[model samples]
Target: MRSEMPYANISGTAVAIPVTGGSLAALVRLPTQLPAPTVICCHGLLSSKDSSKFAAIVEDLCQAGFATVRFDFSGCGESRSASEASLLGTRLRDLLRVMAFVQEQDWNNGQLGLMGCSLGGYLALLGAADSSSVGVKALVCWATPFDLAGIRTALESGNLPHAMATASRQLGEPQDLAGLPPLSRVLVVHGQQDATVGWRAAIEIYRRMADPKELLLFEEADHRFVDPACRNMAIQASTDWFRKHLAGSP
Candidate 1:
């Protein structure tokens, strides 16, 4: 079941989507017109649908006449479970469920794009690559870690335990990225100064991805794009990418 309410003057809707554990809270920003191609915006770890960055991006996307759906992963924000209990796999499942819900929405135009930040970005790529039937038309990831081995190294060297290595072994690498028919119409953005998920990870993703893809690296930006200019640039780029790929040429 789902419940919705109007969102201020933005022509947006506050939505509640049913999932495995409970509800996944979301905000859907729509263009003035109907049947707009939609972008599913996924927030990073420790963030929710109302994050300032996501809000700004949604505004930009809506202004460009593209509908946007920003949602919290399973356990975060107003969702049912506690954040600590949410695992990587659980988050992926939650996103896939959200994808299904988006497909069923009346405003969606059958074209779907995914835009995500940090851990959310990683999951977006994982879903697009691994799930052949996911139906995503385009993808954008910011500060995402592409290689699990690199993540394991960064974590262990930063005084954290070697949990990522174990995750790699248990979850296994995404098979889609390993060979042909790699994800298409992909865009990867990374901050050169991003210490969390180094820029090299973005390169790794770009290298593995099939053609019709792009990579953008901002030298002055940090992991979260602390610089306002950098953040705006990233948002605009994402909006343009979705417009071109999802909405077709102007």
Candidate 2:
């Protein structure tokens, strides 16, 4: 069941999703129409559900007559933090839990989409690849890495948050994108000047995906996409992709 408590000072309803250890903090924004297609937004390693990027996308999606949900992964944002031993595996579980929760909501029309950034994007791929992610029709990945090696390097070098560095140690083997089955319609967006993850990762992801895939690269953008023009382009592109693929939910 969804929480009834009123969330203060937010445009959407605040939800507290029960998990094993605690709960995940999430915000749900609904369109004027009922039973609309739903999209879940996932933030990067250190970012939260309050990301400006997510806010922009959610606004556009709501206006397009789609519902959107943005949640904080365990140990990030408003969600309860985990122990030092907690790793990507824990975060994956959190995502799966959110997916399950969304499916149970009456506001969802059974058509689910995912939009993720950086590490969150990688997690979205893993969730969609999982056998349990039913009703997921499409996904969009932004500045996502193809493998865990670069993440491991970033974690070790203190480039990323220190909390994730300890978690990286437990991420035994590197994941293989080739092993992922063609789960759904995929859109890969990357910045040509992305020094953090590099544009090559986008190419690799695009190549490994099946048909119904697209790759968009911006020459002046970086991993964070700090520039307003670049960010708007990515947001518009993503919204267009979701609108096209998640047209009719049965």
In order, candidate lDDTs are 0.76, 0.82
Residue 17, model 1, lDDT = 79
Candidate 1 lDDT over residue span 1-250, tens digit each: 3334343347467777777646788888888787788889988766788889998988999989888889877646776632222255667777887888878877777888999998889888877755544688899999987655554344445433322222232333342234524788899999999987789888888888777899999999999998999999999999889888879922
Q: Which stretches of candidate 1 lie over 4 Å from their true place?
A: 1-11, 81-86, 148-181
Best by lDDT: 2
The residue-by-residue lDDT of candidate 2 on 150-206, one tens digit each, is 656656676666446244456533354667676558999999999888889998888
Cα RMSD for predicted model 2: 2.7
Measured by TM-score, how close is model 1 to the native structure?
A: 0.83
Clashing pairs in 2: none
Candidate 2 wrong stretches, greater than 4 Å: 2-10, 81-86, 154-162, 165-169, 172-176
